[model samples]
Target: MTQKRLTPTQFRNQLLAVMDKKHHWAWPQFAGSAISKAQLKIHFQQEYGVYVRDFPVLLARIHGTNPPMDVRRKLAENIFEEDTGKLSLGKSHPELFLTMMAGLGFQNGAFGNLTLLPASRRYRTWLDQATLNRIWLVGTAVMTIFVEGSINDRQELLHPSKARSKREIESHIKRHPLVRFHGLSPAYMDLSRAHQLVENGHRHDAYDMVVNHTTTRQDQETILTALRKSLRLWLVYRDGIARACRLTP
Candidate 1:
């Protein structure tokens, strides 16, 4: 008998389920513990070393593989926003992130000397290998769908203990908790504003790109395999950071 294959909806849901479980938000260090600004720097530095920088270039690598025109268009748009921040705030996401770092009192150039932890380096290596060596659809799924989509976007916007109206919730979400709780100034939260503006339908875009482009069962399986590897490596990466932060369960 032949192996059973999933429909596009099933494939999309399977990918989404993987994302739901694999989010870095589940990391214990991010769970509202009162970490000092120094700890936050460590966390951000690890993140920047692996994925925050050169993310657009990774997306462009997939886009340049000559995928279907529709997928290429979407990928191009995503790359444009990432590279130039033309869609959201006037500054690029990387630039916005650096601004936040500055607000934390680090010099603008501190991120330059940042080094990756062992697990973080491994994760970055896998990402580079997958995006560069695998099929374009697999690269797209791993880079755009798995990396960019988040299950907790809405949940993160909610206050942990407050029962507020939608308006109140939205207002509170405008400023990142990093600014309010982490001793960082709100003046450098352009990254938060950029996310609020452009992230509403990003998850759907990731799924749709993978689903629409991957009509064959083999391609869907390939994408799923890449995502599974992504999730596994990602968990280890977070564990490395969490342990470095001395976070307790």
Candidate 2:
């Protein structure tokens, strides 16, 4: 008998386990009262330069590739939301992030002229290379699984010990230290709004795309290899931001 391959859920869970470990770098600082406004500016500036500015294009790369109609439809929905925000919170996610940056006291047009640090530049280069040059599966995994799937409510400052309702999470997020401690207005939190609106079931969609398309053993191995490489590069990227923020880790 032929050897049994791992099921899609198993593969997805394994990948997510590794990805979760990589989040230990700066999330605590970011999601808590630890990060200052100045630190947030450094973090946002690097984030805009390295990835935020180009995320729509990354999703579009996967969309442009000849994926199945079902997958393409999902990718197109995401790209449309990223580029136009018609389906989400009514503003492009990147522009909303810049709005949050403005609330952080970064002047207008600051995000457009960002000077990327070395590790930040390397991460961007890898992102461009992976999304623009690699297979559709690789591109999808990089943009969706690696980038978008990084955050969760459980990691935040107001993380409830018990399972909280969506309304409660939103309430806590509205009073989050990033807004309350930094003195940023809640009106500029479109990024957070957009996320809460469309983030449901996203990781499942990402894994479904990969596991449904990657039929062969070789293809599965390729995705694993690419995600592993992306994770290493992502750690360096976070390290760069953490150092810039002067957080000793």
Candidate 3:
């Protein structure tokens, strides 16, 4: 029996359903309240090693698969901004992250050599294989939809950042835990600023690439399975970080 292919909208809804669960219980502790500098350093180190540092390379792995012209173009644009930040800021996202960390008194070298927690390494190892999967759509969905798309993805798609004024944006950035608690000054928040600037189009582009370019029922199922795995692994990964941070939740 032939399976019915899902419409782009339907597949996207399912993907968003998975993303909605991206939140960890301890996230509120980490984001909403204050934590020690040690805790914050540990958390950001795991994060940098896991994804922040090599995200562009991960995207490039997907692009190297050569899925389609449109897909390639979208991936290229994402890679360009993440690696160069030319379209938004003048530094790479990872560099900007280190700059933000500097405001918290973390040296750039602090992020250069760090060990991943057990669960963190497990999740990262999965990313290694998944992003290099033979079926490009599996890699694409895992990275574009699951990795890049956040829990607020639905809101991002519906409202977009254009609705927010620059003041409103800066206000939100000022409220970040790093700024409010760790004393990371808003002046060093160019990473957050860069995200706000480029994210309006990038979020929509990520959805368009995954939702519209997918062409098969099998590919649809494959992508969904990959995303589900990503969600599970990511949850465990976040749990490990929370434990490292001595967070109860």
Candidate 4:
């Protein structure tokens, strides 16, 4: 079937529609604490190798290509927070993640030299290429909307969360898997705390940066194609990790 030309709003909806399927079959196993501690380490190791550590650098790649000034400001804010934590929690996100891991008895050295699973390697390679795309918006779409945003993105974009109070944040951390299942202290949940401080803005910025900037149908098609490709690789990546962790998917 031939494709129809769509208004920008229609095109944006299609991009978001693709995000609605980002959830993997094995997600519940991970989230529900069905995986054991050693298996959980594999999960976190793969995640750090895949995107957690280099996220700010990916945003910097887009910023380097010189997007519009307002867009640059948004990128700058996100990069600043992830790289510096000056805006939210006073430490970089990756650092906070390691701190959280410490609470679970994870050694900092364990994450130092990770060999990504085969599927994870392929997915990371795709991320490196997408962020390097000549049309900066394509890089922006993959990095921000597709990578950063989650399956809950559709709901998040439509009904952004109000900033939570301190008590609420503490309550949320008490229920975290690390805290509940692995005996991690809520004191080490600064990564989650920083996210609650800034996540809503990030979600809006992710969509608005792509949707507002993409005008031509060809760019729209290009972006949507890249996102669909990302989704497929990501699922396979999750499958690889699930198998390594011995989860039935």
Once fitted onto the true fold, the runs of candidate 1 whose alpha carbons sit more than 4 angstroms away are 24-28, 31-33, 153-170, 173-175
Number of the predicted model whose TM-score against the real structure is largest: 4
lDDT (Cα, tens digit) per residue for candidate 4, span 138-246: 8899988989888888788788788999999999999987788777888899999999988766888887888888777778899999999999999999999999998
Better of 1 and 3 by TM-score: 3
Residues 1-249 of candidate 3 have per-residue lDDT tens digits of 999999888988988899888888988887765678888889899989999999999989989988889999888988999999998888999999999889889998899888999999999998999988988788888888788878998888877767457898899998888888777789999998988887777777877887887889888888888899999999999999998888895
Clashing pairs in 1: none
- Pick the lDDT winner: 4
Using all chains and alpha carbons, the TM-scores for the candidates as numbered come to 0.88, 0.88, 0.95, 0.96
| Arranged by TM-score, best first | 4, 3, 1, 2
Candidate 4 residue spans exceeding 4 A from truth: 1-5
In model 4, which range of ten residues has the least summed lDDT? 1-10
Tell me the alpha-carbon RMSD of every candidate. Answer: 4.2, 3.9, 1.5, 1.5
lDDT of 2 by residue, 89-165 (tens): 77888888878877777875777778999999998998888887557888888777877766442232124244446
Candidate 1 residue-wise lDDT, 83-115, digit = tens: 899997777788888888888787767799777
Selected candidate, larger lDDT, 1 vs 4? 4
lDDT of 4: 0.89
Better of 1 and 4 by TM-score: 4
